[model samples]
Target chain A: MSHIIKPILYSYWRSSCSWRVRIALNLKEIPYDIKPVSLIKSGGEQHSNEFRDINPMEQVPAMHIDGVTLVESLSIMYYLEETRPQRPLLPPDFIKRAKVREICEVIASGIQPLQNLTVLIHVGEEKKNEWAKHWINRGFRAVEKLLSSSAGKYCVGDEITLADCCLIPQVFNARRFHVDLRPFPIILRIDRELENHPCFRSAHPSNQPDCPPEAIK
Target chain B: MSHIIKPILYSYWRSSCSWRVRIALNLKEIPYDIKPVSLIKSGGEQHSNEFRDINPMEQVPAMHIDGVTLVESLSIMYYLEETRPQRPLLPPDFIKRAKVREICEVIASGIQPLQNLTVLIHVGEEKKNEWAKHWINRGFRAVEKLLSSSAGKYCVGDEITLADCCLIPQVFNARRFHVDLRPFPIILRIDRELENHPCFRSAHPSNQPDCPPEAIK
Candidate 1:
């Protein structure tokens, strides 16, 4: 909150993890620059020596902010919340805050990693879709149940918390991979409401500077 | 750190996630009762409606603390740190704290999910070991590099931080799945140092009340 230099985000257009970071920056009204690290081009630019130096994990949504480079999407979000506390991503009440995080972890660790690009490559072309659908549906089943008890126009109450940052991108991934959405009415309602919100709309993959012509939706 | 009720932790003996929660509780010196939710036995206790009511995700490492149940291992740890600030699990400086979280996220989102029980079940019997080994090795490559830069007596310098909570369990999982540790000298070094530490030693699965006889390592 004290720096004059703009933050630099190493992100890829289609990455769900990168999308979470984009949503956070937008919601907090932080000014930043995006340094696209193509996860698919040139044998995955994230694997290049230059990018690896920035993020050894070769993952997207790494940020150069607060005078240091931070990797991992969740960690970046936490740093932003800790340092820039004006527009709080977590609710003020301790219980509500934990509820928000429960949903975030449901998507961040439980859902996204299983259907990730690296896992898809490992599962091979023959089983990737099946693998992706199984994990997404399993994760969504849990998300739906969690939301059933917590929802008040959003994933957890009416506030646009950090959980929404994880949920929208994951739902996007779920639909892209052809997972059935009809089974999850609560998730759909939240996703639809957020789709029209300015913060989430600006962070949507299609609106990003690096979004490919073919990916426009 | 005000409380009169004893917390309840729903955990499974060998779950790396359960292990992470156990360590945090011990490190913070918070007294909590363990309610074992066997991942095996009758097609997994986590899938039961009773457990689902407790944690919609139906995963182990759900905690009943601060008058509400919290799921997701990382979220539980965060709650513990926020509520019980004494003997902090994270460093005081913002940058150092981010480093600790970066390492934790590497294991939580990057490593642990790919080798989870549900993922192994889907990968099938024949390829399960191969799948586990491949992901662990890949994750360790990044973890080792990060530890080499930031580690001292522990994963993030001499102080015990949240990163150690993730690293010790992940290394336990890596060894259980037969992922060789020879290549990761820094990880192995930290693992060895923590092995004798009281917090980690007491939290080992074999030391848990519900650990089965065959799993007594």
Candidate 2:
């Protein structure tokens, strides 16, 4: 194989989607640089023509690798799993792989989008927290129930699969919104375990270069 | 191969995610039964203990196939692709496959979730259409831009990939919410082309057994 340039990830410090990709990169032990695109700075730099050229979606977690740009966190993870092929993020068994993707979709499609910054802005400041908590609680119920059946030490079985990558960030968002976590003991437990893991620890929002001083503990 | 029973899909007639799986099943030529779980009937049969037992997520497009159940449309599609592997939904080339998934995530995660029935319900009666249209338009712009580079006769290329399956249902939703398609000629064109394709036609919401009389043309 030809020598490939190190990937560059265009990410936002607090973006859950970006954080998922960050964890995947670390787990794969891929050397990459973060070119932070502040989502909150100057009313969102993602909307600029420059970033739009990189990802027409103007979304964070867009990655430039292997001479092409990739957008969407789950899609980027899939690319990494295929290209890197080390520290595999998805299980080999078809059913287990499907289960991993199932957990991912539950968070990627079902949970995160509804409570994202865009949606919250539209939800308005008056009812934002209530709206965020409502959706987060509804989604976490599904995640907890899913984890009950599939989880072991991580989200699916004892292996730290892509499901773990998706789960941790959303759990962070749930806490950020002040959604009660008591109902999701499995999720809470898995999150606690993952928080201590080096990959997850390094990828956390508070550790990102763009993380504000106030956000650090 | 061992003798396999036909899959049973727990789906709602007009649910876009369910429709995406329906199209994939048709494309694969897989014989299946639809056990319609009405989303609106009696406060949603999907929320019942019976349905919850099948899918803890309490969402439709759950499939009981190959002695295991699968939830999430994209996950089920991945299962179908891996297990069946007849008429392939994803391309063999890695980058092309990533592109297909990028489009899928654009709809599944970015667009469809924000405008889903649950979100609209929370957005409330008065502001529902406005909210739905707002999200659909934002997501559509991103999709249209992506399609500008990827689309040929279909979403990703000339072939009807998984991206097409995700695209058609979303275009239907965009129409449902009265999102202006004038700015998204590529998306509109692809939707028009796919609407008449046999696989897309048979799997359409209007063609579903559970479709109501008023929904039919």
Candidate 3:
């Protein structure tokens, strides 16, 4: 029931949010096409009128699937889970489900928004980078505390829930910003484990259709 | 079982995130104690070593319950739901639960973090207010679109899920920033409706123990 019309994702290679959706789609084994919204060059293509038609907020990582357009990377991922529940991204139990949401919320809500490129641009380049590092470190420290109790092989119990999917991309961004992750050994350990997984590996920035040659590193 | 021991919430009146937890506690009819962590004066009391011992992040809105100390407002809320499942803040079905989570995620992950006072401060005073308004508008717009389809009496399925608990504080922040919410009729409608409700009304910043009288309005 899931394989009919191909999905189209408006994305950018270096975008952590877009990277999250890409990973979710790949993990679900859902086929999709990519439409790159270059963040650099020409003052951000996402602000263009054509892109705004797809997403009023003019953000990257908007998804068009089954004649429906969904923005917000988390929403797109959830929509995919709803439309394609075969390979579930969430847990089965109510408590576990809430826990997964909590973990994702910590990264998605509590951390990512504080450190995104757009927010950094508004804050000024030097302070923006510092803000990103400060919040990312704060978030990672909290995640380390959480993982200390909750992690086994992945972020939740043993399985890879949406929490891990959200974590990797955020940690990727934190590393790119030169935020030292040494204080978050548990988080770093879980990230190391997931980085090698086929689903996560396939969704790496280098693997994205529009990734630049220099971005592969 | 519910009346055994009242929850203890370490919070501040003007903190929008703290307001969120306060509303959730009130809505659940969970009686609790409030320990104020003033964000201003005394150079932001949350930075004290004493408070930092309670929450490593030194953030307000931490909850201590059943011998567990929980940081992160969303995590604390979820913890309450787990500990007291009688009046569920989540949906009954997996799909519905995911949908509720999607709404919460949009505001929590997409909007709230961007406009947080701490983040604004990092951006500095010159552009701080502008930064707050920009992210608030961006988040509210996405919320408006998402709520337009799902709302009946609330953000999803006419029930007061965690989404509403999240929505009220965000709307309050938006109004505080003068985001011109007229464009978001659905959000405004729900905001108006919730604003009058006892749970939201009582949790207003003005009503909090720490909020100054002059700052209440």
Window of ten residues with lowest summed lDDT in model 3 chain A: A93-102
What is the total number of backbone clashes in candidate 2?
0
Model 1 ranges off by over 4 Å? none
DockQ of each: 0.79, 0.85, 0.38
Cα lDDT tens digits for candidate 1, A100-170? 98888889899999998978987899989998999899899999988988899888888889999999999
RMSD values, in order shown: 1.4, 1.2, 3.4
Return whichever of 1 and 2 wins on DockQ: 2
**How would you encode candidate 1's per-residue C-alpha lDDT over B1-217 as one tens digit per residue?**
5377889999898999999989999999989899999898999999899998998787898988867778899888988888889899999988789899899888998989999997798789999999899889989999998887799999888998989999999998898899889999999988888898898999999999999889786
- Which candidate leads in lDDT? 2
Q: Write the per-residue lDDT of candidate 3 for residues B129-190, one digit (tens) a residue.
A: 78788888887777787777668898888788899998988888888888898888998888
Candidate 1, position A79, lDDT: 88
> Against the hidden reference, what TM-scores do the models get?
0.97, 0.98, 0.84
As for TM-score, the candidate ahead, 1 or 2, is 2
Candidate 1 Cα lDDT to native: 0.89
Per-residue lDDT tens digits of candidate 2, residues A1-217? 4226889999999999999999999999999999999888898999899999998877798998888888999999998998889989898899899999999999999989888887788778999999889888888888888878889889889899999999999999999989989988999999889898999999999999999999998
Candidate order by decreasing lDDT: 2, 1, 3
In model 3, the clashing pairs are A109-B109
lDDT of each: 0.89, 0.90, 0.80
